[model samples]
Target: METSKRLEQALKKLYTAFHNNELNPECCKQCAVGNILDNTDSWKHLSEYHGALKLNYVGKVHQSFGRKFNGYSPLELLQIEAVFLKACGYELPLHHKNKKPKNPTNKDILFSGLSETVRFLCDLDGIPNVMAYTKLFEFEENEKPKYEFSVTD
Candidate 1:
């Protein structure tokens, strides 16, 4: 699919922030939420028909989490962010790398944050439940799933 220029810019910013260890959780969370909502039917309709007015709705979504947006608590919003990130192929933190390091590194902070976010989001409804799919496929097959590592991961 062809990504919108705005979305591409947002992704580049996110990647730079991640690599530089300069990620602002709040801003990244808002951007992720915005990107996710922008892809939804309702938001798409608004964007297509109303143009700049759609930004108002995005802002509302960003603010709504404080008051439990779409019945999701503030904590749940954070989880949704993590799930979204993972779905987009962001790597969560690992406890060990090649069974050598038993502890998490400074960079692991990013993973830990994402991991916590995904854990919470999975507890809610209407969101894509990746765990169910990942687990089912993992156990149903004898061989581990093959993944192509990329610089982003």
Candidate 2:
């Protein structure tokens, strides 16, 4: 199998374990990173220039994790992070060599909408909750922003 496929499988496996309540947050996060490294196309670049993969992966991981977990548990957080990394061409099991960079700011949580297309990410270290998009558009009498659809977990 291709390295990418293997990485993807590992990441999904981690997520599945988490959804099944079979793993701890720290373990899940740590294990999933292996996939990230194995899949990074930047590995060649990082190899040619020391630290390139580490810098590139850190930024990529930060961005993906920022997008996936809007408001959820640590498990959910890792799942989303894994999803983003996979999308960006990292296979899964993000590499330890990729090395996590310190986030410039603490905020990295997901928010659904500030506009129809835009979401404001909450700080990573803070609480997670869906930032309602309804507040942006004023409704006519017949048109509510679909709050009933959103109320459940």
Q: What is the TM-score of each candidate against the true structure?
A: 0.28, 0.21
RMSD of each: 14.1, 15.9
Task: Estimate, for each residue in 1-153, the C-alpha lDDT of model 1 and write its tens digit.
Answer: 333343334334433434434443333323344333332233322122211223245445554645533444334434455454443334432112312222222334444443444344443433443332222112112332233212221
Error of 2 at 32 (Å): 15
Give, for candidate 2, the lowest lDDT window spanning 10 residues.
104-113
Q: On a 0 to 100 scale, what is the lDDT of residue 119 in model 1?
A: 40
lDDT (10s digit) by residue, model 2, range 1-153: 112332234334433332333322123232223223332232222122221223245445545565322223323334444443433334344455553324211111111111211111123233232234234232335543223222222
Question: Considering summed lDDT, which 10 consecutive residues are worst modelled in model 1?
Answer: 132-141
* lDDT of predicted model 1: 0.36
**Top candidate when judged by TM-score against the true structure:** 1
Q: Which ranges of candidate 1 are over 4 A from the true structure?
A: 1-23, 26-106, 126-153
